[model samples]
Target: MFKSFAAKAIVPPALAVTGFVIVCCLLLYSVIKTDMLNDTIRHETNLADTIIKSTRYAMLKDDREMLRNIIGNIGQQKGVEQVRIFNKKGVVAFSAHHAEVNTIVDKKAPGCIACHAGPVAATSMGRMEQARRFIDARGRSIIAITAPVYNEPECFAAPCHVHTAEQKVLGILDIGLSEEPLQRTLATLRMRMTVFCLMILALTVGGVSALLQRNVLMPIRELWEYVSRTRRGETGLKAPVYRDEIGELARSFQEMAAKLKSRDDDREGGSDPPADR
Candidate 1:
């Protein structure tokens, strides 16, 4: 009876609960990781765009100092690692880190690699193609995005700048943002989610096991005990009633017991013998 109760009432629910918890944890983790990645990308792209808009007038007036100041100020914003303006020749025309100004960008660098597939840059790139991610020298993850500076009437007509009608792309605005802060936040959230799921799983499984033991296993055990007592000649034993297959079995047992008792009573009351012949 103990073995039967363990198998039927305990093992199945435990296995089910474990499988359910594992699947939920995996699905939740996957969703959280994807959302984190998208948010980081969007944030970096927006920052790059903001820098481009703020420095446009300075670039048109050929004011190097104003452009440097704008890029430097934006670089101080939280999570922004570096900012640069690259000319068509792949030269660092301006940079937040002043030391990097005038330095030539490598063809294989994250910011330029997608556009400069070979010796020349791609004639045009879609908005989505300008975003990339890589690891920095300090091993921190970094998201880099670029926004192209296009030639407009104001740009070509500026007295301080050279005129060019054929030029479509003037320069590229590049921004790199650190992902360390985001990574830390995600790690903490993952830990909390794991703990919460485990707690719920434990409570659910425990409640189910307890209910099964009380409603199913206990009644069956009681019926078995009642039958054993009756077999030992105990009187007045009653089979327990349940509303399932077990209940039907209990009813049959009670009927059999009553029949046995009636037969015993008849034998005990009968007259000793039909006088032999």
Candidate 2:
């Protein structure tokens, strides 16, 4: 009897709660992961912009030492992997990592180079600056931010300033940042979310199981015991009572048992005598 009550009352609610928790957890994890990835991308892009502005000022002043120092500082910053400066002629003038210094990077490279090289497109090279990402030799995991190094009229004159919008490229600043750190951060968040979701599911299942046992299983078991007693010829068996659906069901069972007992007794006492005798 107890087993029957547990089967009907405990299993369904437990299963329902478990399934709900699992679905909720999966949804939350997906949302958190997407948000984290976007946040990391925005942070890295902002860092690139800051570095570009600082290096631009140094370059305009013709401060090679200061420019090198600034580039080195940017490279040391978290998420920054490498930094390179290109002159208007598409020649690598300075690099944070020594391996790239004096190496000529193709002006036709992806990102800003696609438009910044050859003749300066009016739309591409405005008074403001632009930034983008491209793959380096290592892979397509590098971000390349570029800003044109214009010769300030007060600082550079004549030949250096002669280059106009129609002239050949003057210079570009490129900064490359590693994507590993961002990915790692996102992975950690997903793992944590998974763990938290599991914990919630376990708690929900346990709570549902307990509620079912108390409210449904226990009362049903008591009612079953009453019916069994009456079946074994016990008189005046007391039916289990309650205030909700379980109580109403117990009352109906008690009424049915009384009618069956009455019918059995009438047959045994020969309430209808056989016609032949």
Best by TM-score: 1
> Residue by residue across 104-159, what tens digits does model 1's lDDT show?
88878776778877876786776567778889888888888888888889999888
The CA root-mean-square deviation of candidate 1, after full C-alpha superposition on the true structure, stands at 4.4
Candidate maximizing lDDT: 1
State TM-scores per candidate. 0.81, 0.67
Q: What is the lDDT of candidate 2?
A: 0.67
Candidate 1 — which residues are off by over 4 angstroms? 1-32, 118-120, 241-248, 265-277
lDDT to native, each model: 0.80, 0.67
Q: Backbone clashes per model, in order?
A: 0, 5
Q: Write the per-residue lDDT of candidate 2 for residues 1-277, one digit (tens) a residue.
A: 5466556665676678667777877787778766765565566556656766777666556678998888877778876777777775567778878777888776565665557466754334432235455566776466445655554454445443445545434666666667676567767877876787677667766776688778877887898888788778887777888999978988888887777777777789989633321
